[model samples]
Target: MTTQQTFARRVFLVAGIYGIAALLPQYFMEAQVGRDFPPPISHPEYFYGFIGVALAWQLAFLLIAGDVRRYRLFMLPAVVEKLTWGLATLALYAQGRLAVFVVGFGLIDLTLAAFFLYAFHSTRAERG
Candidate 1:
């Protein structure tokens, strides 16, 4: 397969894995509430929000990479968003508010940053 296709597949797989993993804690909490698995000390709304953001970001990358020629413009926006999220995550971590879910979210952002950097290099190589 083409490089773009390969990259897209990887992104999709990673995103899907993360999405599934994100829901695991919630399920465990429900299945073992007050027994084996205790409810999180903090509310889960922020975690869920991050999960949603990760899902959307990954899906968008999959779609864009699959059609890079037609969606080249999306590259800039994707890079900007990824960088923004990364900085935000770092700030949160610095503030000591980054729990497991936030760390997972930060990981996703870091992955995106790496992928986008590779993609940018590849695109530039093709252009030159």
Candidate 2:
């Protein structure tokens, strides 16, 4: 693999692992999160749904990592995936509606989005 491919692999792999580690526990943390964050998550469907979708994206990241070239087209949606959550959290944080802790996680996603973009650019030559 070239340097770009290596970087893409690492980026996606780390993102996947990190996402799983961070999100998986939330399935069991509904109560704790409600206690800590307040407002008590009135809708279980939305909360669990978000986690489910986010977790799915993480798996997709791993799939892309397995074959960056073959999945090059996927990088675009991956970037959007990161941005959706990252931007939402950061925007909420800016409005003073979210906690710093949440913003921190959002920043991570934003940073990864940037790297994802770079990775996509780097792999352009690999596209067949």
Best by TM-score: 2
- Model 2 lDDT per residue over 1-128, tens place: 88999999999999999999999999999999999999899999999999999999999999999999999889999999999999999889889999999999999999999999999999998877
TM-score of 1: 0.56
lDDT of each: 0.62, 0.95
Model 1 misplacement above 4 A: 1-5, 12-54
Residue 123's C-alpha lDDT in candidate 1? Answer: 59
lDDT (Cα) of model 1? 0.62
Give candidate 2's TM-score: 0.98
Q: Which parts of model 2 have CA positions greater than 4 angstroms off? A: none
Q: Lowest lDDT 10-mer window, candidate 2?
A: 119-128
Write candidate 1's Cα lDDT for 1-128 as tens digits. Answer: 56864664466456445555654565435334434435543656665676567667666766775666555556667777677877787888889765556666767766776776666556554441
